[model samples]
Target: MSLFRKITETVSKGVSTATEKAQQTVEVTRLHSQISGKRREIEKLYVSMGEAVFRGYLDKDLSRAETKVIPACEEIVAIRGEVEALEERIMQLRNEKECVCGRKVPYDTRFCPSCGHPFPEPAIPAAEDPLEEFDRQETEPSGLSSADPFVEPPGYKDPGEAPSASDWADVGKPVLEEVPSAWSDAGQATPSFLDDADAVGAERADSAKCPGCGTAVGTTAKFCPSCGTPQQ
Candidate 1:
């Protein structure tokens, strides 16, 4: 049902309940008055019986007393029973449980199905987290100086001291030398005899030694340059 309808229903039930109790109260009060009236009638009947007996009329009074006083007493008992029944009904009404949605819920129910409102919960001690307790225990100091081994000793420096140039002598920057060109001799062009040194084993191919006179000669010559030797 809608919230508005539920509220309306709850209000209607409450008003009707109040009216019913009011009616019951009226009925109980009426019954009490009836009981009181019946008691007074019984008392008056007893007084009449006593007066009749003192006048020496016991035998005549007995029949009339039974007809009046006994009925009155019976009425008082009946009224009292009605009063008790009405009182019990009042107690039952008081003990009834109702939800916000106008639904009749049991007294011991924890939650309402229609409105979803939970009843008051009994207070309970909360449980501690084991991990949190362990962390707290670890935070406490051990009171011993040798507890930690990773701690640095006295006089210990992070990077020792700054190094000097002498300390890097073996690892210093190298010096590079300019290489001389093989095709040049003292900044001038090289000689052809030196160029063909490897091909003739350091002997020039255009110039040969005369075998008989040990003089040098050109390859196209008919005789040696220093000795008169015939062409071979």
Candidate 2:
């Protein structure tokens, strides 16, 4: 073959190889994507199957699948262990005591400041180093310069504590007068206005006088019975 023809042929072969490699790469990537999608679908199917099995048989106690239940229980135990490990790590990092609400508190804390729930004092080991304990207490949580802002400090007073003399400023202060009872009266402990009304009516009837002629009027008279004058 001529030199020019050889060079042209070599270039064509190289171009074809490059194109083939590119096509292979594209095919490989497409296959990988399909495999990933299939894996996700399989995972979802497994979850659905577990849900169905548990709901139909194991949960209802009709039958148990040791194959499924045992594995699930093992996973749960593993997960719980991991969670406890993580919590211990967090507690160590934060140098805080755990509250019932999963909130961090101080070692010396008597109660959860947030929830007001009392804390159980942990038993101390005799061989424990005082320096380490002090350092642990001194170490603050990440992102905090000092103790957790939500936690009350040493010697802090809770709002629920019994009121002191200073708190009694408003205690002895005059309260609003209570409403009078229905039966309250000067004669009784609390006389009603109806009683006074009856007395007033009796007085007016006994001393009934005419407005125009000053004549004495009967209790049921519309006008003076003596002078025939109208009673006001």
lDDT string, candidate 1, 1-232, tens digits: 2435555897999999999889877876765676667667656766765665555454654555555556656765776676556545544555546556665545655555344566565467899999999999899876767655687889665686876677688676788665534443347776656757677764576677767676655565554434445546
What C-alpha lDDT, on a 0 to 100 scale, does residue 188 get in candidate 2? 58
> RMSD of candidate 2 to the true fold?
39.9
TM-score for all models, in order of appearance: 0.26, 0.28
Task: List the global CA lDDT of all models.
Answer: 0.62, 0.63
In order of listing, the candidates' clash counts read 0, 6
Q: How close is each model in CA RMSD to the real structure? A: 56.4, 39.9
User: Which residue pairs in candidate 1 have backbone atoms (N, alpha carbon, C) closer than 3 angstroms, thus clashing?
Assistant: none
- lDDT per residue as tens, model 2, 1-232: 2435555897999999999778766665655565556556556656855875777674776355555655666665655565566556545544577868776765655555455566665697679888998898778555765554687789788888987887677876777755535542345554457789998888776776768666555455554434445455
Winner by TM-score? 2
Predicted structure 2: lDDT: 0.63
